[model samples]
Target: MKLKRTIIISIFFVLMLCGSVLASPSSNNAKRINSTYISATTEETNIRYINDKFEVAPDKQWTIKFNKEVNPLAINTENVQVLDSKGQAVNITLGLSSDGKHVSINPPASKYISGETYSLIIKKSLSNKLNETLPKEVRMKFTIMKDNSNDTGNNVNPVLYEARQGLDKIYNLVKTDKERALVSALRDGVNTKINNPSATIDVNPLKDQYGNLSSDEKSDFKNAILSNFSIGALFEIKSIFE
Candidate 1:
């Protein structure tokens, strides 16, 4: 009887130990984000990252993506902040992608300053759909390259320079004379507006040029334009043709 009682007690302790092990959370089983990327547009093809920094166009929207789907409710301006070198938060609007794995941050209508360093802060509060927090908080630093035309002085508008560069790229990409002419007209119109803000804008010559391009080409064109121009310049151009 003594041996039987000792055996029963051992069995009870073993069961209890098993229960505890099952109830405890397993660190090895925790889910984590697989990867991340940043882009100037919503298209995945345009996404880019360099050494933990995103080289973004001044006037474009910034899209941040995680390989794992995130909890939409947890994504907000409070959890993601864009700070300048001085650590002041820049005015921005946050938007989530349809898949709930990406967020788009739009700066104030003015766009980011060229040749300036900015930090994108993703706070610890952000979590995946499973309610698991990121392995750690993420802070990414990036710099907007100075506009090519700004070589002479700081007075040149970097956004405008970017717009011109975009137009130049488009011109080089087109093979047909009609497309080239349309791009040239658009480029000329933009240049006129930049050189003389009061000049009467005319985008009518190229109004229909974009209607026939493939979706990929359209995205590429948009990226070029946004990369080269500032929000203000875009607004001025829009006021003419939009």
Candidate 2:
């Protein structure tokens, strides 16, 4: 009777061990995304930004790398989507690498709109070779480069060009040397503030210079500058006087 009871206890432990092994997650189930990027150029790998605000060429190709080998069947257009700023879907073709560990996305021709933002979405239904799905859907945002050419004239962002022209007009309107000097000082202060890493910037110097102008002139000047350049770039011009 003692020997039989001992044998039964051993059998029970063996069954428990087997059950634990079966319940453990498999290697494929542990797989996850290792990295992602836009292949901007032959030598460049533009790493994916957490904020999803990548600036890329109009014809940029996207790539996603997995920590483990994936099932080629898991990658498809239905699992991946590219959406424009307006939330309209952009057509794309999906391809898996030879090892099935990487997926590449080829967006439709002319699908990327210049100066616009886009989102690359990976659905949660995407699974690995073991049929283990991702924990959550992934969404990444990117912006097509406003100007992506080597030609000097064409390479300039249109809004930047317009902003520079507005600055030129402002410079011309400053009739006195003192007023021109104040504008120059303001430009320098703004540029300095932009280059600084600190978030809270003191624009008192620029504000003082701006106070010298008439209220109506100030309003018109502000409108011209803001309309031409995004508020973000208006502070970083190399030469506002030019």
Candidate 3:
């Protein structure tokens, strides 16, 4: 009976030791989490102020160039949130690159407050995916000076811009997805003219009166849209300057 009791006690001790060893690694290798990390990967990631240019025309729409090339996927952004210093939300979300190798933060004019330095916060972002916690923040400062164009406006009529940008690219063959989407979207305007007797469309943007874009061009435009920010899906409607 004593030998049997000793054997049981030995097993219990072994089980306890195994449990302790299992818990130790988890406590050691747990993810690191903290606030106060800066969002910028490089020290050069500074916000250049175009206030002087826009000051003349406050009412008109404008664009500010970050010149900061951000790789969204490399950041491993689990969820991205942009905020002002007061902690108000800026209307922009995180968008991933087609290859998932990069990331970009998209913000419209509505979210930006003139003369304010906004803070961008990112959480659950790591150098790799499946990471637990790697967060960061960056403060961007800029002020909206008044716009001074004769009709300086942020609201872009993309149809006009499309004509200007597409001027050089001849309608060879709608060989790309980028070309196709552009053709498809412009076709919406085209069909309008077809059904309505009075409706007239300037067919210049639609690739010489024919609405067609190849799969290859469509792929190019997909990248272009990210960098160009074709939110309205109209190239001409996008603002050139702030």
Candidate 4:
């Protein structure tokens, strides 16, 4: 009777081990499936990354895809946003696919400015049709590159041409870390002014940085901007920095 009891105990332990072995692969497969459903992708043909930031065209648009259908109500700008380097939100238009598994992020009417960095923010508040939100927020940083192709057949403004020339000189002269940072902050409005003759950008963002510069640095700033920017551009810059 003791020998029979030992045999029964060994059989029970063996059964338990066999059950776990059989269930392991199924558990792993479920996690893999879940990851795909929660992920997203962009539709760019040749996506490129530099210094952990995406290098995109000035007018680039993003098409995000998911394995699960998204809730239509979660498709507004509040859930999906684009913000400039200063953390100011850029107005964007969103288009949802009929199946709701894809959404497109379109740039503003002025599009993005070349030589500026922006962030595309996907909040955790975004939910699917089942009302399940994302596990975390997603933020992507990108820098805009000038799209020469878009300039074709457009008449060049002479004042903009001179302004760009002055900016090129300033770019070559930057040496200190502070100077570089200041130029980077100023590039967005400056680039826009040259790229679009009619564009009137708010230069108020440059105030604090400009105030921190040394006297010589401030003189260079005035010479580069005041001497070259168009009359309208000069007015905005002067009002903000002077």
- Per-model clash counts, in order, read 3, 0, 46, 0
- Per-residue lDDT of candidate 1, residues 1-242 (tens digit): 66754443333223212211000111212222223455321112322222223234676566777888888888787888889978999888888888888888787678888545577877777888899876556665554543446445423333444444555565555444444445555545544444444455533334455566666665555444434444454444333322
The TM-score of candidate 2 is 0.44
Q: Ten-residue segment with the worst summed lDDT in candidate 3?
A: 19-28
Give the alpha-carbon lDDT of every model. Answer: 0.52, 0.49, 0.33, 0.54
lDDT score for candidate 4 against the true structure:
0.54
TM-score computed on alpha carbons, candidate 4: 0.42
| TM-scores vs. true structure, each candidate | 0.41, 0.44, 0.27, 0.42
Say which candidate scores most in TM-score: 2
2 against 3, candidate with superior lDDT? 2
How would the candidate models be sorted by lDDT, starting from the highest? 4, 1, 2, 3
What would the per-residue lDDT of candidate 4 be over residues 99-132, giving only the tens digit for each residue?
8998889889998985566888888788999999
lDDT of 2 by residue, 1-91 (tens): 6675444333322321222100000111122223356421111122222332323566777888776677778787778889886788898
Better of 3 and 4 by lDDT: 4
Off by over 4 Å in 4: 1-53, 147-242
lDDT of 1: 0.52
Model 2 residue runs over 4 Å out of place are 1-49, 148-242
lDDT of 4 at 28: 9
How high is the lDDT of residue 208 in model 4?
58
